[model samples]
Target: MANDFEVGVDVGVDPDAAWRLAGDPVAIRDWFGPVSDIAVDGDLRTVTMGNGAQLLERLVDRDDAARTYSYVVESGIPGLTSHRATIRVVEAPGGSRVLWRQTATSDVEGYDIEARLSGVMTAGLESLRDRLEGAAA
Candidate 1:
């Protein structure tokens, strides 16, 4: 079975500013803590985790005008069968809202995929808010 998760954060910056940072695949390492580094070659991105694990992802869709981008994990993570995620930035009253939604499936039983992914997404959004808000301040 697959698990779905969505997490978001409000930052004290305009949508354009937020999108500039979040929409860029290569900039993920700047705000995402677990990502130690990322290398992008065209529509494919290779992400290196802090623990030396690597994940390969392919960009499926992107709309700069809409401030949204999506990708699917082609490989990486033990037992993970499929994974897709989208990041979006939209205008909010204070500044902008950044949303991250993920759907994932794994072959491993009792793996608690939701807990793992949601925790990481929450922490990453917090980090993103801090970085963007701090920069705006």
Candidate 2:
């Protein structure tokens, strides 16, 4: 856990539905403003976050039994270098819960900057929920 970036979203869709939408790379390019394409090669992936921010990371660990995937940043992004996000999906009272567990190391400045970056993940998750549940491109 290097830089912390966690956000939980409860979309109106079912858990399976949310997972389907979230795991689809094509659906990702649809809602994420900067993420042009998500190319996955083995455990490594390159996600182009808007504004020319290209993120390179690797799937170091995963618990298929738990339906959780953990990835670490290999390059790109600002501030902290190392990063990881483990998404957990569960059924909610009405729909589903998408919990994003992430972390990053603050560079030289401080953790406040890292905290702000957490908002970015939150916004992105919200965008995913809005776009998928609404089924609008």
Candidate 3:
């Protein structure tokens, strides 16, 4: 079984702007991490971060009308197995809401590493929300 966790952020941007920003892979990288010069070809995106952490991933599924996109990280920090995330954009009371749902389990480490990854996920999601809201503001 996979562990499931979800986080959401509401931005003042409308659904159309949110959808456009969220669905665009380059824009995603821009908001998500220490990403630099990111590029996407179809479902695949390659990003290089300043810290030298590289991300290579593939888009698993996307529903444009639904404003959702799913992806699997192919290789990022060994010993993590099947790291998958789903991001959805929705119409919220204030403007638009972005939700991130992630599923993953450690392949080689114990509880401490799991907790650490959870923190990383949380921080990243929060940063993403900040970036989106800042841009839309």
Candidate 4:
């Protein structure tokens, strides 16, 4: 089954500033708490999670003018057959809104993919909002 999740958070910073950090493929570790390290080679990215598990992803598309980037996970996650995610930063009323969206399919039986991924996305967005807002303060 395919699971879709989307999470967004508004931060007190300009969109460009948020994009400058969020749009960078290698800067995910700075905002996404679960990510401990990241290495990027061209369009490929290797992410090491806090638990030391790694995920390999391929950059699908990126648009600096739109402040958005998308990627597809290639390997390193058990049971995940397919996973594609996109992150975008847009101007909001007071600042900028960071939106994270994911579509994933898993072969694991009875696994609650939405619950798990949504939690991670929500927490990551909160962390991003804090980091960007703090830097602007």
Candidate 5:
């Protein structure tokens, strides 16, 4: 079965700033708390999570004009056959909104992959909002 999820958060920043922060690979650790280390080469990123898990991600597409980025997971995470995700930033009434979408296929038994991923995305987005808005304040 395939699991998909989309999560978003609004921050007190413009679309450009939000996009710039979110799109930077090195800046990921500042918001995504789980990422302990990030090594970027060209369009590929190797992320080491806090729990010692490592993941290889390939950048699939990036549209600066649209403030969107997409990537696919090449490895890591048990039972996951495939994973693709995208993050997009758009203008909102007070500031900007970032939306993260994930689609995955997992064959692991006794694990709620969707819920876990959803929680991670939610926390990450909220952390991003706090970091950007707090710095401005």
Candidate 6:
């Protein structure tokens, strides 16, 4: 089965600031869940989670004009056949909104992969909002 979802977070920063922060994997490590270390080589990124889990991601598309970035997971997470994620920063009334979308296919027969992914996305977005807003304050 395939699962997809989007999590949006509004932060107290302009769209450009939000895009700048969201587009950098280094800044993502500061706010996105348990990411401990991030290393990038060209278009490939390796991320080490706080729990010592590691994942490889390939940058698929990035557009400054649209303020969007997309990537596909190459390996590391178990029980998933494939995973694709995208991040978009858009202007809002007061500040900006960061939208994270994830789509995945589970390798297992009956796993609640959607819920698991949703939890991670929610936590990451909340942390991102806090990080950006706190810095702006």
Tell me the spans in candidate 1 whose CA falls farther than 4 Å from its real position: none
Question: What TM-score would candidate 3 get against the native?
Answer: 0.79
lDDT of 1 by residue, 1-137 (tens): 33787889999999999999999899889889899999999999999999999999999789999999999999887887888999999999999999999887788886656787788888898999999988888
The lDDT of each candidate is: 0.90, 0.70, 0.74, 0.89, 0.88, 0.86
Instruction: Output the number of the lDDT-best candidate.
Output: 1
In candidate 1, which residue pairs clash? Answer: none
Candidate 5 lDDT over residue span 1-137, tens digit each? 32787899999999998998987767888899899999999989999999999999998888899998898999987788889999999999899999999888777775555678788879999999998998789
Q: Measured by C-alpha RMSD in angstroms, how accurate is candidate 4? A: 1.4
For residues 79-120, what per-residue lDDT tens digits would candidate 6 score against the true structure? Answer: 789889999999998899999998888768876656777788
Q: Poorest 10 consecutive residues of model 4 by lDDT?
A: 110-119
Cα-based TM-score, every candidate: 0.93, 0.79, 0.79, 0.93, 0.92, 0.92
Candidate 4 lDDT, 36-126, residue by residue in tens:
9999998999999999999999998899999999999999988888899999999999989999988888888865567778888899889
lDDT of 3 by residue, 1-137 (tens): 33677777777878878888777767766666656667788878887877888888898788899999888888865777778888888899978887778777666645234355556556665776677678766
Residue 5 accuracy (lDDT) in model 4 = 74
* lDDT (10s digit) by residue, model 2, range 33-100: 66777888887788887666788878766654455567788788666656676777778877887777
What TM-score does candidate 4 reach? Answer: 0.93
- The whole-model C-alpha lDDT of candidate 2 against the native structure comes to 0.70
State the weakest 10-residue window (summed lDDT) of model 5: 106-115
> To one decimal, what is the Cα RMSD in angstroms of model 6 from the true structure?
1.5
